[model samples]
Target: MKFRKATKKDVQAIVEMIADDALGKTRENFQTPLPKAYYNAFENINNDNNQELIIVENENAEIIGTLQLSFIQYLTYKGGIRAQIEAVRIKRDKRGTGLGTKMFEWAIKRAKERSAHVLQLTTDKKRPEAIVFYEKLGFVASHEGMKMHFS
Candidate 1:
């Protein structure tokens, strides 16, 4: 598989991969379909060197997976840097074929290139398989992730 930064032309494919999980349900709990605003954000991110969004394509050049890496610089840790992975998804038929691992490895390299001190992400507790997959990738549950929903 080959990986490259996502272009505007890849938005529809990204939406499809994200909205159609292997479990047959869209990962977001909201009833409404994915919004255009969400995708527009990618436009700004794609232009920023600090934010990277990548897509994985097979030998035939068909997009099969996507992931985003956001770099954060902090002063509290004396100028520490971190990369957070988000929206990692593989097309339903592409799971367990090592594509996910390849995407992650690419993200890791991007993080290192950006001089990030750590890489992190959060997965829903309901997705036990995802938690195990993160663990297998050498991630540890170091903190209790929290969220405050407005709606």
Candidate 2:
């Protein structure tokens, strides 16, 4: 497997992966050839020093997974930074083959390299399996997180 920062060329595969997750009980609303407005996020990711989107590929050069890391800097924390991992998804057939673990490990390493004080991610409470996976990776539920969906 190979890992690389996402480029415009990767948009299609990324969109497909995102959409597949949405269809298979994931909450993200990504669509193929994503609406023009969504380009802002992709463009901003490249320009933002605190954000990264990575894509994983197979030997055949097909994209198989993706995840995002966003660094949050704050005044009270001084030198500390928070790396928030998000949107992690692997293709359906690739599930249960340890790809998820590798993807998460890579994100953790990258966060550490940037001197982040904490690496955190949020998973839907409904996904018990994912909660277990995160716990296996050393993540603990230290706080409650809430979201208000704008419908």
Instruction: Supply every candidate's count of residue pairs whose N, Cα or C atoms clash at under 3 angstroms.
Output: 0, 0
TM-score for each model: 0.88, 0.89
Give residue 26's error in model 2 in angstroms: 7.7
Q: In lDDT terms, how accurate is model 2?
A: 0.86
Residue 85 of model 1 has an lDDT of 98
* Global lDDT of model 1: 0.84
CA lDDT scores, all candidates in order:
0.84, 0.86
lDDT of 1 by residue, 15-86 (tens): 777778644354443234556775678779987878888888999999999998999999856798999999
lDDT of 2 by residue, 1-151 (tens): 9989999778767767776754443555566557775577789887888889899999998889999999998866786899999989898899999999999999999999999989999988877899999999999999999999996
- Cα lDDT for residue 17, model 2? 75
Backbone clashes in model 1, listed as residue pairs: none
